[model samples]
Target: MKRFLIFLYFISSALTALSSEKGIIDLADYHYNRKEYYYSITESMRYQYLYPRGELYSQSMLITGKSYYKGGDSGRALSVFSECYNRFTDSEAGERALFYSGLIRIDSESYNYAAKNFREYNYVYNNGIFLEESIINLSLVYALAENYDEAGKKIAGYREIFPEGKYIKQAEELSVLIKEAESRPEKSLLGAGLLSAVVPGSGYFYTENYMLGIFSFGTNAALIYGIYDGYKKKKQFQMIFFSVIEFSFYNYSLAGSIKSAHEYNENKDFKKELVLKFKSEF
Candidate 1:
């Protein structure tokens, strides 16, 4: 009986090992397709560890990195991508890992790092599935880094290279947007304030707050006129009362003019920056 039980235990152990080895990769793929990213990572890593020279070894590493990225662990995702690409150079999986890592870097706003990876990708592969995407991302990274001239050049060069490419319009639009951001009016907060001090309400006009400028000028003119008329009539008490109101209005106009100048410039610059923000891919 003891010998029979020992024989049965050996058979069961062999069957379990065979099944685990064969099904490991398939299990990882199943989890990845279903968006069970954590499960996918576990199984993919298991395959990589147990079968380092297996047919799907590179694929397992790619799967593991992709799972980490899609599962919202960017740090781990980058680590895995780096390891896999380094381990399996000059292969589809290596190129794919590099491309995905670039995307992850771009998402994190690491424009310079993303640019390096994309440039390396271009250098490594003459042409492949990610060629167009890498070029497009390079243009975007340049723009995000505020290298407007470089960004424009990239866009123009890409258009020449791929006139009928799928993402040509996006690159062109980015170039146009960069130009728009560069042409912001050079009006200054200090200059606007000083102008309004010299010529009441002219500051708002300079800042393009036409309505506020008009209202400021009209209100100040009325108040000053009232105080002057009170004084000319020799109504001392009335003049003093109106003078107090005029002083308050006068102080507010000066301070408000400076504040309005600041607000207008701040809002103008904010909108200009939004052009870049909207164009940048998340």
Candidate 2:
């Protein structure tokens, strides 16, 4: 009975894999808890391979995604997380997949895609653990991406959905900062140059450099007064020399003011982006 023997061998292999399932899952979890992500990844892969139809199939896939993420393999982590939920829509692991997928997209600076993922999570898993966090972060990502209009909508959604959400205070503060950020261009080349030309230090003030603005005002005022004094003294040599100095100093101040404004805006935007990025990491 060659066919019967072959069937018996298949049955034995299935029984052996079934018995090993508990050990496989346990070892994976043990390694994961110890932060041995690479080792955890190996065990998870083995379990998935041997137990394709196991009860823990979705959990195994989730473990694999988490391990890849912990091991600093984000692209791989995203891939596995997507596969987990795509394969098991009804499992709790699918809820986790939604959150992690959005998180990884944020880390990768794919803000729009991250927003989409978070939205899906919010709609599908309304009672999920990370829902509040997802809503708050979704608004931040849009702001960070410079899509302020969409960010504003997200804030409205946050308030409507969570009038006194956990992150309410945080969201309010961020909104204030973002509103301030939106009030003016970081550096307006034409604006800076025009302001500098009209008022020696006003451009610097507009750029929020008070000290430099004061210095520019004081320096230009002194030089201008010196030229005037020399002219009134009827000293030809002194007048010419002081006039030239004043002219050059005033000209340089105008250019410097514009440059400073540009730099100030650039630095401010950079810092804002950094703050947004750091929030995503946590």
Candidate 3:
């Protein structure tokens, strides 16, 4: 009878412990669902403290990382995710942690690191739940880093690997965007500088800065006419002053044209478009 009673006591204790463990994670999840990220993190941390070896340990850690991420604490979130991935590399939670790490890196504009994380995830998890997403983001990271050729290759590989994938449409769209970006016209810096040197503001026109071009041309023409008039009228002071001003303006115009050419090539529009597409699709 005593042995039977002791066995019942132990079973009761085990059940209670199990319930407590499950309860804590459920509370964390509840807070997370309600967007109470602070409370979610608190509860998740509590779970980790109370049950270091619990079956739900990975889940609690993941929730903690996600809460940090949602709360705009990317550095902490990344640290947590990296730890989770390192500790539980074979678990579902680990896979998700690695995926989120990649996403955070992307947001931070650390494209190389983001690409590495996504590539590692793909390599480690052949059948990962986030496989399609990883592939797409890998391509996006490449594109963001301005490696459009590699980006195109990644998208092509994604299409080949997952023809009916969930992100197939996004892949197709991104592929189109990459092609367009590649084909977009680029202003030549040498051409712009040479044009400006030959004709005051022609370089600005070459880079499509019509207003600046007009303004520059007018200013230079006025200065040149002033110098000529001064010279013809024997006004030495006026001629020398106009000549100095024109020289200064001419150099300024040349420099400005070269800078504009660089800006045109940088082309923020394509990057902005790509970013919007990534955000919308993801």
Candidate 4:
């Protein structure tokens, strides 16, 4: 009875191993055919563990990466594709790995990094799958980073390389906007003071700086009121003295008002320049 039990146990263990192997292969085929890529990836990975040196090893990795990509896991997809590219450089699957890697980076908003990877792939494979996309994304990154000069250079490069690209018209329009902004005059707060110096209240008015103008006018009014009030009190000597002082200071306020305008204009120039620079790059 003990010998019979041992034989039955051996048979059961052998069948279990065979069934597991069959299950892995069947699940892989079923999931792949049904376009359930996420499941296909799991089954394929299991198959790899069971048969590390199987003929399907490289193909399985490619499928797993593709599944991750389609399942909206771009970061993981990129990692897997990078591994495939490094581990199986001679395989046909490896040829496309870098191309997909660039796409994943671009999708993930690592625009500058994507551009570098794409450029490398293009250099090696001349006719890389996503060359135009790489160029467009590189241009966008420089623009977003406020590097207008470099961004402009990149746009020029794109025009030369892909004049008929799908987004050529949009790129051209953006270039024109940058040029227009670059041509505008710059403003500064100090310039407002200078404007006020040249013409009382002029600087504030020029910069649409009405509050400062009102404040300047109010100070003059207060001095004038003080002079008149002193005179109305019937203090003859005091009234004359206050009147002269008020008159002189009123003139001084006029001069200061003009200086304030100049400062306002200077400020305007600076702000205008800042806005122009930002728009040009972005």
Number of the predicted model whose TM-score against the real structure is largest: 3
Best-matching candidate per lDDT:
3
Candidate 2 C-alpha error for residue 175, in Å: 1.6
lDDT of 4 by residue, 1-282 (tens): 999999999999976764475566566657767779778888878878987887667666777787787777877888888888888766666757776676566456575776677567657666555556555555554554445687688779879988898758766865775565456454455665565555445555655658866765566567667767877887777777777876675556555555654554344344344334322110
TM-score of each: 0.63, 0.63, 0.73, 0.45
What candidate 4 gets wrong by more than 4 Å, as runs, is 1-37, 50-59, 90-92, 165-282
What's the true lDDT of residue 72 in model 3?
89
Colliding pairs, model 2: none
Ranking by lDDT: 3, 2, 1, 4
Residues 52-76 of candidate 1 have per-residue lDDT tens digits of 7887888888888888888999999
Local lDDT at 135 for model 3: 88
Total backbone clashes of model 2?
0
Lowest summed lDDT window (length 10), candidate 2: 273-282
The residue-by-residue lDDT of candidate 2 on 88-162, one tens digit each, is 766788888878898888777787898889888888888877777887778877776777787778878888888
Least lDDT summed over 10 consecutive residues: which range in candidate 4? 273-282
Q: What is the C-alpha lDDT of each candidate?
A: 0.79, 0.80, 0.91, 0.65
**How badly does each model clash, as a count of residue pairs?**
0, 0, 0, 41
Q: Model 3 over residues 81-143: C-alpha lDDT tens digits? A: 999999999999999999999999888888899999999999999799988888898999899
